[model samples]
Target: MMSDAYNNLAIEFCGIKSPNPFWLASAPPTDKAYNVIRAFEAGWGGVVWKTLGEDPPAVNVSSRYSAIYGKNREVIGFNNIELITDRSLEQNLREITAVKEAWPDRAIVVSLMLPCEEHYWADILPKVEATGADGIELNFGCPHGMPERGMGAAVGQVPDYVRMVTAWCKQHSKLPVIVKLTPNITDIRHPARAAHQGGADAVSLINTINSITSIDLDRMVALPTVGSSSTHGGYCGTAVKPIALNMVAEIARDPETRGLPISGIGGIGNWRDAAEFIVLGAGCVQVCTAAMLHGFRIVEEMKDGLSRWMDAQGYRTIEDFRGKAVPNTTDWKYLDMNYKVIAQINQQDCIGCGRCYVACEDTSHQAIARLVDEASGKRTYQVIQEECVGCNLCEITCPVQNCITMMPQQTGKPYMNWTQDPRNPRAEKVPTAA
Candidate 1:
């Protein structure tokens, strides 16, 4: 039985114990008491409550959300112009207290955004603390609508502001403080280092990239158009996973913020995505766009899939594979320049598709040859090894999986990479006898 496996997936993040590492990100899915209770019932281990600010919350438009569809009409990307929770601060706090009281086992971290003023943070800190939530996530990452009010990315883009605000939260709140970072800045490390310097217990990222999903060419208006006007909102979903992973790795591997715990958030929709983030050094992962698309019940699949995969891989717990991939991530200069591989085709499994041949001949290196067999008058394809650069283009173009494989060339050359290659101008030289 999958349940019979002795895999311990529970995690302690920022001093809060979660039944699992899957937490609903502070988006629409975790905005209300009903949503959070449903999420917990759906098997989610935790949730970061929707961003809260001072009372008299910001107004929202009728059509505040838009989506980017794939060729099959799947929501590959999502965009939202919605601001923080539009409910009264007291109502939100009351609900948080009630929910936390009802489900004390589940992690409840409230997401907060206010002016960067210390007093503003001070004023709200005690109210949130009174709720008995697990922690506080500083909303330094919302890309749109909130920044104009001097919150959200406005405070995040500035490292000094991030540090100051984080310090203020830490000073006022006894709960663990996590700084949710914005990805808009040039170097993500600056804010990450700043969060660390400010004594953040953990850092969650990336909030969202500033994006204009699409424009109606005929109308000349952007999407989620309200009265033919729209502004760039936050973009999330599968499309942002790579960006989020890179940022997480940047923080995990940086010397300054090396040991800082990360709560990975970006385009995470399934168990594999969550596992990838965990392996990349995220103690937990936050899901928004996926949950928004598929609903809360998807956590059942995420939990089951992760548990089964971990059992099969002999991982006794989440920590077994957590951050294991970090060491493998290195600079491009360290790549082995002498490594070589040649494409080989399995004639039986080729399916006679000309995709590989056409792709290689037209768009990629011309390395595949189409020939005819005289015996049965059948067409056969082969790889021209000499011209094949092992680019994997032919393999990727092949419709049939495993029909094309790259066979590594056995080169006697030592593992010398671009950084040490004599051809490189910046390569270090070994001293020679005069």
Candidate 2:
């Protein structure tokens, strides 16, 4: 149960006010007007309408989806070869206008993609603007089919194309423009800088990573085979959350793109995931694969949980904690070398599971030992402090939470890191680690 006497989750993104910061990403979840309205009813604050293109919508293949599973057979990764919205451009525009009129308070940003030519982008900007939608997000992240046609990831992969198309959209449309970037590129900052230079109001990241989830060993075909053949697709879901987080942090911490409003999009499935993005500098968070898997009702849990969590943390609003974690996220060269910690086993809490012992002895450092209690003839495991590196593997392997913990060791030495160490040839050495 949550009390209303707490923080305000409302946020202003790109000059548009959303009741909360949760928006449905441009995917299956926001493909139609009915879906968008239903999501809003379910407590989502906004939605990026499914990506649209010029007339003659692209045709999608049958069996265009696949899944990657975990040990328990839970779907952790999702793959899709589906192209942009296949509905007629006019029909989508009509629905967008109706949905926007019905829910004027909610943010309705349309996601778009088209040919590389400025004329192609120039042509659709006014049509989208006429719908009175809040803004536009260029969908340059779809990895598969469309890229071959010089659109989607094709435009996204090249910084020049991203900048050019973004400029075209800004020039032609009066609406705020957001450039949704792809993760396939070697450096995400390149495209982000390009978008900012092109006059985008904000940027949303981590559209999707290029991937082939699986291959059918028996059939010798890729996953979601469309009549004995398949192509690479965009991967999403919990499996991609780590990648998404790092990319978001990279952009948030980069001096070149810092202060640019970011709408985080990736494997965000719950309040905690959304909080992580916000703390890492997302003005708002968008969800897709999770909605596709569980349905729109999940937004209720997200809203309630985020509001309650905010209350507990003493945060009065989203801005209080947004980008709070950015300073702590830095390069390896800046990490402390003098600080040290060692693993400790809590004998009382230990269930005598030797999982940690086996893990440390075999795969990691030989820090844990299996011992027998002479009096009771009980088997137990203990950590050898001298050899323990505080890698946290023992703690991770221990099934009982808090059974194995890392205790800090006071080195009584001034802080130093690899960047300033005397042993390094390039660095002008500071005091070496004692």
Candidate 3:
């Protein structure tokens, strides 16, 4: 199914061939037609046009965002109370038609959301189809301000609603429909199965989450304060990558929706994040915060980096090793109990800055060694073989090239912790009365 001579850069998403798996997600930056067209020209595989709904129903406040900054005061997390496309329906369709005509190969998935009514969906499906875009992504995942209006997450939270809306779209539109699920629900699979049952060709998740990072203690307002007040807004960016990955894996591994095509989103910042999703069964990757944070041009690095890494790994096409790693993942109880590890320090490369020591001693287990010169009475730092927890913190904090390493632990006695290893004589599940 793969050819070594062929470039492995391109991947398929929702039955659409994307030049790269990376796509700009539906967010403020990719909302406009001008922005979407530029992104397609910038080597992006696709763009999900901002969520659009039935006419005259959507409104937005100008001052709707609040941001959380890092120590350097850069925005690390964003909060937005904005609603779906405030732009006119005619304008979006006209733009979509133009962009698709220009870039026929690039994916042009229009993200849609309307009232739960079937008539609303039936009324507009033909209109959207007239644009000749690749597909439609149901935007039932937006979490905050729009929920109260009985849209976004309001539709996503109920499985019946998800199934109902997806069926309507499928019935009305010949184009592939992707049901984007909300992360607010406890069980993601419920909505995922509902989408599948409703005849959705694919599903993408997860949309932004509800969050309020901090408060203005003195001013008595939340961090992303809009005129001295704020509410829970959809959070995106680098912070939510792990959450997105796990949820993607869950759906991929679940028997109910295991074969369902998934378009991974939430916090994909770079190529590695994109690759991880591919390995875990995502057909394509979506970007929002990363593109918004950097710029549309960042897709250049994403494409190049993925191509290089794939080449190095001997992958000639996107499907060569797709979902290859999923089989390797197993339940925690099935993990190898015999493996061992230790911290290995490269003295020549060691800067001896002591940041690693501070991190390990004050916070983590004091598994590091203090080397002493008996004659001169001077001391140096190293790793303690017996005490180290094998966390790799030293390797992470090490300033030098190869200062610290986590050497694998060969099979030996089982780790005798209260919870971890089965061979540990004392290990047992917490007791419950029969």
Candidate 4:
């Protein structure tokens, strides 16, 4: 029997076929021909080439990275102020030709961002098509550097600019045009709608957000040090997944851009993240920071794992239920108001480290208490019940494995008439009049 993961996997990005719905996002590593070709050889379904732009006539700074890690030392968030590729346009084109020739089956998308003028886009669009590449993606989403040069996020932040530039590409090129939008804008739907209005074949996001890494206590420098200084860079990684998914859903759920093809990008490191993007209505998922951190070989795992998961769930292909999870999602207001639970402490397995208790008392509801017994000389903790409010902080803060758990409370209680959860009190039964 095919695993649930693999049984259902098909990707059609702008008429390009993908064995799976995952693609590599444009970034530094995927910027050059060598890395991209290596990625293709490693089983990636498609690649959105690094953002190619009109020569800035400037060189980028060295060492650009900002990271936020969880307690386990795993990097949960990342930021980078990387500029476009420093390589010459001809060098990129030459490699594009060779890579596409070798991997004709894989989708090759060239990400381009040039001056906003019609001539600049018109000049590059046709040359990009001649590369034998499958399509062109307008890079309106870079959060830094390029935007200052009158491209990237500068174009994306304005609806008119988005529409005008995308239309220019559509007019100048026969190849499909995918508009990549920045996540920094207030309303993502506007840019997505603008892309559609401009006659774009599809829209992809989010091209990172403007970010400030950290300031050096002594030297007053930000992260990804460029000789004791830094500027706002793009923020990404698993930390940004929630934000990306929400933006994609907004576009998917919007009346105007609901049908707009979405290539989801951000924090997509593994198959599960990719699958989540799919079920939320993204046409395909893209990776950048993940590939940069783990290497192109990670694609092997992403494909196999996603395929296995689909087969296990009885999905025969990607289309079997790509957006199956989106409909069930709802706003907080629509959530059931009666749901309640209290955290349970597993005493038998409890290590008594008190991490949960400290966390609860200090930052959360004072829902837990530690007790001491002189007879046994041992100590343990218990939930205070009335104060829990079911926030699950104790569970998250617990040191031992599964030491703290949450159990749903009995329903049909008298409704609490708070502002957030309005009063829906049950009517008292009364004797019927004869």
Candidate 5:
């Protein structure tokens, strides 16, 4: 449990307040009242209820999940072919109203999906508002089943459609509107900008990416194979964290969308992941795959860890550090051309595993040298600094912690970028920053 003295996790995102930053995303983990109640009991700050559509509801396929595993058989990536809530609208609304009434302090933002029509938005917005939920997240990012029906990613991929739909929802409902953006698009900024222009209060992202996890060789069909045929599903889990972070940074730093509230959702499994998103400008974060994999109790660790970290960092609130990393995130062309780092092996810590040597010699630059003792036949590895590109491959491949480290070289040259480098043909095109 987070101590009351340092309980700084509370956040108010686009007018929706949550006791903590962790919220269950609108996936299977938040499908119904039963699951949502358990999540709240487990200490989740909130939940975006599984996407609700018009009745008669959307039906999902059985055997809807497939996964890519790490060497230890851990689920590194997850795929799902499931669609929106299959339950009727009336039932979902009743339960939503009950749960919100029961736990008024917690956020209960409803995730909604409807056809690209003004009448549909106008009809359903009032019904959802009557539930007394905190807000509504437009389901524009489901990349799998819903797209085939001209919903989900189909509407999300088009900026015009996103703006129009968002405008319709805002016009129809008084509740705060959050447009969920799809990751399948070439540039995420376009849809995000459109959502902002259409009067969205915030945006949650990186809804599942399109993917096919694996194929059953014998059946010649994708895993989670159904009746001998299978289709691509949305990919998620820890493997997508890097991609998610990059996209979040893109939107956070974009001049047009700057200061737009973001609810980051992609491969967020722990406190560190959530903290990274927060520093990169996410006001709050949503979780799905992590809860599905480890159950709802994981929020306990997430909350505790984040609280402890914040205390150590002298941050009293999430806002203190939010968007701190956005300015540091920039294009590679702006990187210092003269800056350099080289690998240095700590002989005392080195176990002589030679993993670093083998990795650098074979795959990366041949920067590590293997030395053999004449009498004892003992082996030692040393870094050849001249050849080291400071790519950190050797440091990454080493099994022993702190065995290989990258040390920055004291290059006397002033900060210079590719734009000012004399070697570049277009060096004169842009003025160098003073």
Candidate 6:
């Protein structure tokens, strides 16, 4: 009952095949079988059930969510003080098994977070494996609530712990293990390398950041205030996309972890976000905040949009464009220093708003010139090519689209990097390109 146009969206990540690359993340959205079943009905390819722990599960606070809103009151970033599943382990396992059996075509990845003991992992792995779920994503990334108990980021922030627990899971279970990484660490590469060393099947990231969205000035406390106080919660949504992309790229290009499958997470709200993650080396992508904001039906847009894009790009399969951008993602030191670009103003499209002039003159390079016609009392703004650094600040601040553009200059100078520049104190002794 599926169209051939979307056939290319299918992907097999770490041996778990799905109808498409979109999966609901292990969050409140996938907390129950009912929610997950609805998501599947809405065309989501898979779901990583909400993170589970041993019975007598995590008791969450009443006011668990806080959000930072955009000008239009849309949630730019979401924060949650809620802990893992508060339901009994037995109940969660039963639902997972039933869901898997019912929707055999959809991928069901169970997310787990237990104590960092080998015996604990040894005890739980088989119980989850018996459910016939497609995979297990180790929840080592929760930044709040659990970390204080030495379970989430407390374990993920340490490389040895990541490797040891991952090893234990591999030893105890036949299912693929995906180590969900915490972005709270200093360098994301360490834990990714640790997962690889411990023989993980794949890795997913970046878990919510530790943050406080805002404070109630009236109460004089952080948001989602419980009584007189509030604690920092996990921060997610569109605000974290840039950070997620960089971390995904880091693991993708690292020699120690190259070729290791990645299930990208963080701020992936639309098909474009999913495509960006794939191009940077994620085999699949997970979504949470977007679903919470827009409901399960959002996946329909994601699926249709991604399929259309793939068709237009002539990419027959996800693998065709996966990691295609990794080679081009490089260090700034390797960038061409001789490349020159300047801002150009299209007077015809300019509304004479003078926003570009004010922005550049006040804060940036003062690269824009404002001219007034005395006879007509009309204002015009132009880019001073000599002063423009091609920072694009003017263009970004401009209200009218296409009014300002950054035009590259053919400087005739050969490609030169910072390492080869004479201005560098420790310049490499390499011949310049002719």
By the TM-score metric, which is better: model 2 or model 6?
Answer: 6
Most TM-score-accurate candidate: 6
Candidate 6 Cα errors over 4 Å, as ranges: 1-5, 432-434
lDDT of each: 0.91, 0.90, 0.83, 0.82, 0.93, 0.94
Q: What is the TM-score of each candidate against the true structure?
A: 0.96, 0.96, 0.89, 0.88, 0.97, 0.98
- The residue-by-residue lDDT of candidate 6 on 188-256, one tens digit each, is 999999999999999999999999999988889999889899999999999999999999999999999
Expressed as tens digits, the lDDT of each residue in 18-128 for candidate 2 is 888989999888889889888987878899999999889989999988999988888899999998999999999999999988888789999998998888888888999
lDDT of 4 by residue, 197-266 (tens): 9999999988888888567788878888888667889999988999999998888778798667889998
TM-score, cand. 3: 0.89
* CA deviation > 4 Å runs, candidate 2: 1-7, 431-434
- What are the per-residue Cα lDDT tens digits for candidate 1 across 1-434? 01212237788997988889999999888889999988888878899999999888878887888889998899999999998998889999999999998888789999999987789889999999999999999999999988998889999999999999999988998999999999999999999999999999999999989999999999999998999788999999999999999999999999999989999999998899999999999999999998888888898888889999998999988989999989999889889899999999998898887889999999888999999888987888999989999999989988899999999999898788786899999997755689
Report lDDT (Cα) of residue 244, candidate 1: 95
lDDT of 3 at 255: 90
Q: What tens digits encode model 3's per-residue C-alpha lDDT throughout 1-434?
A: 11112247776766787677778888877778789877876778888899878777477765777677877988777677788888889888999998888888778899998878889899999999999889999998999777887989999999999999999998899999999999988989899999999999999998988998778899998756677677788887777878888888888888999889999997788888888988988888899887877898898888888888888999987788678777776557656555677889877777667778888998899987677789996667888788987888888988776678789977666543335555566677645579
Candidate 4: deviation at residue 117, Å?
A: 1.2
Candidate 2 weakest lDDT stretch, 10 residues: 1-10
Model 6 quality (TM-score):
0.98
The superposed Cα distance between candidate 1 and the true structure at residue 248, in angstroms, equals: 0.8
* Candidate 3 global CA lDDT score: 0.83
